[model samples]
Target: MTTNVLMTVPTGPGVGLTSVSVGLVRALEQQGLKASFFKPIAQPHPGDEGPDRSTAMVAQGSSLRPVEPIPLHEAERYLYNDNIDELMEEVVGRFQASVDNDSTIIVEGLAQIPGHPYATRLNKAIARTLDAGLVLVTAPNDMRVQDLEHHVEIAAGSYGGIKAHDVIGCILNKTIPGSLGAKSYGDQFARRPIFKRNFALLGQIPVAEELTYPRVKDVAEFLRARIINAGEMDTRRIQSYTLCARGVENVLEALRPGVLVFTPGDRTDVIMATAIAALNDIKIAALVLTGGYEPSAALIALCGKAMAKGLPILSVESNSWDTAIKMQSFNQEIPLDDKERILNVKEHIARCIDHDWINSFALNHEERKLSPPAFRYRLIEQARALNKRIVLPEGEEVRTIQAASICAERGIARCTLLGKEEEIRRIAQNNGIELNHGVEILDPDSIRERYVAPMVEIRKHKGLTDIVARELLQDQVVLGTMMLEQNHVDGLVSGAVHTTANTIRPALQLIKTSPDSSLVSSVFFMCLPDQVLVYGDCAINPDPSAEQLAEIAIQSADSARAFGIAPRVAMISYSTGGSGSGNDVEKVREATRIAQSRRPDLLIDGPLQYDAAIMEKVAQQKAPNSKVAGKATVFIFPDLNTGNTTYKAVQRSADVISIGPMLQGIRKPVNDLSRGALVDDIVYTIAITAIQAGSIGA
Candidate 1:
């Protein structure tokens, strides 16, 4: 199995899919596997309100914070429009929003529910799209032992058979414990022929009725009980209940932990007995008084100490028997606040999971594909860890301000906004965004004069004067770049409402190029549907010498490697190697030679056409022996016009998300955003700058 992505699918009815998912995650963690959780789309329950239960439940106990599931309304709308691909892309995007590269992601599949006829088809599509191995979760329910093989076969048949779906195994949940007969689940499905040869018996979780019991608060909400003493209601759990029709001495034995007792409010002897149990540290869930009777004030004073100790006492409008009848159909769904119970359920479920199978299952998880989500997830994590400070020049722009707030909140970086504080806040308020505290408001008018002297000092050789410097520092990008140049900030992001030249020219003048680089260039991390490709010199260096192009290629390749993409640099041209004669083709061919001689340690090949560079079949026919052909992660365009046009075309026509114009060879990190960039685009740009400013993989 390709174990990087595991999809947990329910075989049929009566399966505790969320419970199984929670248990599988815990078991993987216990074996020291770095695992993450994701539920792609929400399955909104009928007549219910709030988030998906599976998502809330899984996320409550997860070490990795999973993204909220895509809303059912939005998903159904996409489906109604026949935009299945768009829906799937959104799923991938949301999953990647929280998924990481260092962990195996266990995706819980959509349950086949009423009114949702596309559940199974969507499940199969998601599994196949993610290249995930499927683990079918089933329960004994009413299936006899003899029916085990038949059940497995039928369930496997639903998704094009076991072999076709890449079925890893089956997990039998909620098995009746201590059944010794072969006809029972004592053998845990091992006796079945499919288990013996074709399929794996992953685990058999016994019926732990405790996991299905509701807490005191859940009972209160369900029964609409009025609280007389709202004590430890959240923590107290209800496993069983007894009616106080007998004497107090007989009822005393039922006053144990996790038991709910019913009695008349005037039954002073029973109330006193429950209070005594609470004083002895016995945590009965709650004492429910029926028939609207209230204990005398003197009796309440007697039980005052127990009530103070968090003993919950509730009152109902109905008789004891009627209250019992009302609770007959009590929903046993796990409450999000019941942490202890959830943990216990997880532990029990994990204990029953086959530990050996888990380790062996994901043994080769590292071989999984480096997807766009994984790549972006890694970049953000690295930037967050470094915690470098990045400044935004266009901080008053709505998207820029929103991005800054997000960066600060996520710990991606300390964002300093170089604009008027009140103006920035106004923009935030107008957009209904709460500006995060980590975003520092630096009014450029107040700070511009401070940078004048330093900016002139750096550019005095170029005949820069104080007057010119003051005027230059008026541009916020210049001010922001000067802050970076003077080590006041680690990086700068700009160009939301400014031209690219306005953003980069200041950096070129003040910060200058790095010592090792001859000139500056740019690249965008093009997030293609399948993989991340680096398109270089796309935003900088309009025209270049063969040597300058070579330098750009080498620099772009290093940038790719620095950001965790294995750099297979492909110098793009209109012609294949030695196949055409032109100024462009010759320049690319000579540039490839220069780059190859300079960096023999790198995978640098070029004079390859775009098709030859990106398509494996074309590479086989045209440039068969080139190492950087067909599988290149870094594409070095010969000139800015071609690079810019190609990146934009691919980004728009194919609906790809690109992270860049990340500037290369700058002394400090200073990146430029597209004038039309979105809030997410700006946020990722900030992250890229922060990452560039620090030592990654340290």
Candidate 2:
């Protein structure tokens, strides 16, 4: 049977109006209801001049056509020119046009109140004309609960007057408990003997992280920008809903097995209410706070203790009401049309789609900081795009010089090479590599005098005199990096003749880490013919601690994502889960814990044997509930022994094309190549280094 529901986003920042609208649609659809949504009023263009991505997400599963954008003035026209009766007629007309009579129609109104010229009053009034029931969304904060009085007043105005049987109900969103601003208000509203019987809360929609942020495609389509934070986004995992308790009934009803966000600032009543909600072990991620509202010193201490023990806490500026609404709106991230059917569709899509592909799409569109894949054409185009100074450590190669010459001719970075000018010229001429005009050629023997003094000064604390430092700085690669560090060049590409260590050591000791990270590590692309895997710690750390392993997982996951791979981290150990347990298992488990603690946003599983980490059937027989086990793209080795042996064994036995032991966690992408590395290895190293430079600022 058709079930027509009118949904209104409650007033508050981060309120889940859009999200609830979407989720409700999904829930309804799952319950065998044919659902459709009506956004009679919607913001025209948020950023880009494209169709709203929200509408697209909601309609993703539908056989129906996409929602047509409603002009900003359409609401005004219907209310003013068309008249009230005619406005309802049009609403019904559009509803009928959008869905078959057997399908349920959900009318989504604007968020603002009437008389506030910009409020979605027009949509509400139209809903009234259609004789639809109303669902009011509110944050479960005391203040938000209190605000419901005014919202109810406003909602009543849409219907000409408040009615006893209007079917108006409340949906509280983003409920981190103990922040009772909404609870106080909602309680007071219910206690008022006159208006007491008018309102009933239908459901309390808890907060879910995936629902909070827009999807990568949606963000990309909205911003019209590329993603630079590729790795970070890949590491982000979606968690279940966390709710705030606005009332005892709301608390009892809202408390499901999902995560719940609770504030330390709640009264005993609210705390007890939430205590009951915590019976389920769906994984409590954190407790969030609004407006930097720190709980009392005692509660803060309590939470701090939890955090110390690896529990989490998330804080945002919007109050409880806003948090609730925003939590519900997480459904918007999926671009669903009907609010009721949004949740189911998104969950299905989340399960069905390859997260890595979604991550890759997001990498291209979001943050715009991560480097794109090393497409040969894009690499050449990038070199031709900027005018920064470029340095080639091994400037003697004919191919290297040829590439440099092409760059110079294109007005890209100025090319500088370390070689004897006469020798370079002879090789260029003999190999048909053009010596582009204005390219600077420096000989190690001749340039020592110019750079030795500066190198000595830069490393003055090393107790080296100018002469001694000059001898140490004799290596041309070292001199080249010094030049880049001294701002003489904007970028560098080398490692053709050099070992990975030989190429990177100079940069590491001299250039230093970026402001954001503390240590450097290595990551290899591990590109199998069919898919790419990211392996770490085969280069830098001989044997890392739990903390270091965690860092490696986070960083490698990021690296995998940068190259368009989904990063499900398998923290590999000798034992699978607790099987064959020992310090080794403890180390892997500890590392996994630290990684999750540090990121708290990544999908990481540890204490897993290599087989369990990679093979789905094996994982199913082992840690059946683990999400990252079989799908892991990033593998964290418990120690250097296992990590090295596993990678080499896989490389030899499977005949897979392994790209790294790519060094990461470093300030720059200074890659290490194995002894007797091929020309293809050198090319890939250059591509990686170039990609790093392109994505450096991020």
Candidate 3:
């Protein structure tokens, strides 16, 4: 398994590295991509610089496996001896040992701390050695909204410019909430022009108010006070501490759940005030004595009901001022058992990230080779062997002329350009195209009469009208379809300047659906960097019924098999399994059942979400114990609305190339090209048409 690594390098010591790491893992998992976590060298845990809590926290928190880190001292010793190469060797070796194939691994880098003088240099070197993509994790601690971006710009320089391909993006941690420049977190939305630059802002985690409080148990331990009444010590969390040296009348107003009170033990009024609130069920966290003060026997007796109601009171041995200063220094750090908060943090931060970028990153990694698909190689080979004649209706269109020229030159097909011979020649000459053998430029004017009688005969059922047939023959697409009906051309490809209706209307009238097919559907061969996937009914059905959808699914599976793509058909829907329901989901479910029952030979499953269909990790969680859940290659959308939108989104987001809406089930091959298709797209559509032409006879 060749491992792909994304090393998350922090800007400094406290950038919420663990929180960011946990959230990132969850985000990837939510997208159905498998991600693992690794900390190469341990960093400081709160109050101690030993035994990493980040690894332990994430390991316990997520299902993803986390590799334990080498002790910081051992790693630093290598730096001290200047044997950086050996240290890198150790890091990479240990990292690769834990690697899994086709899964992304997130390596947490050493923080830029006072202790680790070579942390930055080591991080870059380790990243380079591992051939890892770098993701910068930053925190705007003291830097204002305007200045925070400069830190990212500076840190990214160590790796490369921000736009460098290996620099994945940046994740901003501990962001203050509010409007931009409004103190803490502001208008840092995960929108375009993210971060006021071209910098990729993957996520911006808001400062959570919940993380500000330490558990009451932790506070009790830190203060080293005797717990006279240990009410809800382990369960209760406290923040917003107040030195309640004032009278009961003033302090009573602030008594609330999570507010810690510090008052003199002799302040019976304050104690009574707290007891009153407790009796009223205000849920005050705890009451602490400052300056070694403890209440008298009568006071303790009086507060028995309050203590029973679970209000903790602690007596400390320091002066009020001294205890106040110590409490002020206490930190609000995460404890291991707070699973609910940990999960919430993961979900919150995951929601903040730009999922589109992460999905693209995952897809890019999945198909990183960036080579022509094997199916494409097969396309040219098969089309060339058949040597079929492909008729282009939009011959005068610039792109069509170039495509026909290429087809003729490469022997991909015998090209028949239906346009004015002289006009076609002039257009080719102006475009610097030297056209030659296997290319036939027919003047549609001369051929218009030859196809009029055939058109009239074919459409005579609609209405016998020679006048109408001649008028219809003026349309190049109608002319092309008529030529295919009479076996004058092996295939017809149009729609470069026409709508889908224009391309199909003529075919339906003349060369309609083959006897073996009930419905005429279309599919696009999406070319990823490594492989090809077939998206079906995208350009054809708007909202097919369950029965028609089944037929479409079966036809798509057959088409994919014909095109050399293994057909594990996934019936795509908005939900996975029984997780969602509605008319939409029910349609997909019925389609899957009908298709599976009709074509038992095909591997088919449905009501699968986009991620469940392609990603094994998500499949395992969402639709596990089912066949064709994760390894589906051919996707049958329930309707055209979903199919078209999803295909375009995936194509643009993943930077994929797609060909066709190659009209299937037509007796003779007919395909449509997008208006915005390039010359190369037309050429491939021609090849696909030729292949379809061959499939008809076979």
Candidate 4:
């Protein structure tokens, strides 16, 4: 009976959960449909007092009902016995009343639907309860393919060996536009009949500024309007057009072909010249009439005739060009396959959303094609195929041990722990965390044999000796990385209880660069439910020279492509297109130029304010010809100070979730994790590591 479009996103570890969710909400809302979002399980930090922080913000930004967030703990109380039905009943009861009288409701799931004790049951229950259609949002990186296939297997299997209806379709998030290899992944899913039958491709949302970071240009494009009482003009023509007041004949004379005429609609002199230019085949394409009034009847008739001959007219009601520009610069560009189909999107929600869809998905099915058990096994098999050795550096911790045990129990990896063997065993036993059978326990002392040789090799290159290698190898982080490079392990993870420098230095000294890379860069896959937003050089290279920034942009864009994100890059700065002048602007401009020259294959804009990069209105005002403005996915910051502060500010202030500072341009496996990383961090690092290993061959 609820008019809300009940939507759910099923997630797993290393997936871009929030990114997909954010993009989906944006896309749905662009159609004027009211939509709401909910997070079933919000991981609470040690001293947090708020609701699921990410979910809370999503709900706030969404077009759905604006309900106060229920604290995670309070929500848990209603999950009595962790029953799926109980939780759904409570959520619906609590949220139903607060939602708009008519709006769509979206539910965001935690990573790995089955990883949590009650996840499997909760997913199905909510699906059935809301009668919502399931949209399985997956990250499109190399590791993501395995994850997708794994999800497919689980859907075919049981929620817990019990059968139920599974997800209906998939939205391939952060997909690169021209990456044929990535695009071919659709065929891989098609090979599986169950997934093929259930999987509908809603669309692949690429990495772009419009979705990743709010850019001013995107806003400009969105708010722009055609000064009307005239005929049809070309959108492309208006793209590069500059607006000048009617009396400013000097400015008009100085203008080029893409200039917009701004005047009262009754200004016959301006209209006649513009029309004559078009008739004479002048390149002039657009005009902006101010004063909030239409042209005289005679002028309208003439304009109507011109429109019949193909000169488009746009009407604006603002009195001044500045006012018109300001008013027209507040909207965003909403891209759908067909803008006209937005109505259908709303109707689809109205007709298809119902109780049957929700109930069917909620029941636990053992025979479901993509059962959790199958997904786990599939990842394990994929790991084997890659010959990747999964290392649990924080194995002494309870969470790490549990994760280790799970991986080992599933035969997904050859697991290793960082602490002493005895200490690991004691901690696992005391904490009731099972250390799976044959899980390898390695102490810093034991890894010496495996790492010493690689350390020696690195030292030898530096004109040092075996003695120095032994001393550095004594450092666990260094030794761990050395172990990986030496083939003692295929990957490594350390950062929890260690500094970024400590975690990364070892790899930097040993693993070095990829064959073609000159310098290393860092990026984060800000995974939303329907998209993966990539941010680059936000971690390393604090004040890179223009050349370095360009390299960073190129590297980030490539990394995005590898992850199936279409790389529309925005070189963000305080100034936009020389609008505001400064050394910083110059740096960004140079970086943009270099990046365009370097890649040539990518869409990029520089000296753009954040809003201009992603917002339509801003895009129109500045950098009109820019393909990247208002649609960039890869945001290359001017400097580390700005990049770090901006990313953090967006995370803290805007309530946006950031996923990485993923190390790039490295020759082999070398990644840094946040000091306050959770289990999910380790999982993503492993995923990135796996992808890095594979990228060598690629």
Against the true structure, whose TM-score is highest? Answer: 1
For candidate 4, give the lDDT of residue 607. Answer: 80
Q: Which candidate tops lDDT?
A: 1
In candidate 3, stretches whose alpha carbon ends up further than 4 angstroms from where it belongs are 1-3, 49-51, 142-146, 179-199, 296-298, 361-698
Per-model TM-score on C-alpha atoms: 0.55, 0.44, 0.51, 0.50
Of the candidates numbered 3 and 4, which has the greater lDDT value?
3
lDDT of each: 0.82, 0.57, 0.79, 0.59
For residue 411, what is the lDDT in candidate 1? 86
List the candidate 4 regions with Cα displacement exceeding 4 Å: 1-387, 392-394, 406-414, 527-531
Candidate 1 clash pair list: none
Better of 2 and 4 by lDDT: 4
Show the colliding residue pairs in model 3: 176-184, 176-185, 177-185, 178-185, 178-186, 179-186, 180-187
lDDT of 2 by residue, 1-698 (tens): 11255556455444656656655554444332345677665554333345554466566543335365465566567667757566566666766666555445566666654344646456556655666666666564434544656755565555443453554555556654354533444445555432555555544444444345333233223323233113212212224444564655565544432234544234444444443333222223334444445446665444343344333344455566666565553334433333323533354222222222223212123222111122222334454554455677788875566656655654554678889888888666533356667477877787667777777776777776987767767777788777766766666666667776777778787777766666787765564523457777666777887877888888888777665566789888878776777776887789988888887777888888878887889989998999988777788876667677777888788765566556566565455555445444544454455556656644
CA RMSD (A), model 4: 27.8
Model 3 lDDT tens row, 1-698: 12367788887778877778777766665555666777888876557543467776665444445566777788889988999899988887778766566677777787776756788898888888888888889888867655666667778888886767688678877766655532234354334243445556777677877666677777888899888899877766775788888877788768866788888877888889988877766667888987777688888999999899888999888877788899767866666666556656776677667777766646453422211334654677689999999899898887898899889877899989988888887667634466897788888888889877777777777885889888888888988888899998999999889998999988877888999888789998887644578899898778999999999888888988887777889999989988888998999999889989999999999989889998899999998887888888889898888899989998999878889888887799999988999887898899999998998978
For candidate 2, which ten residues in a row score worst on lDDT?
A: 366-375
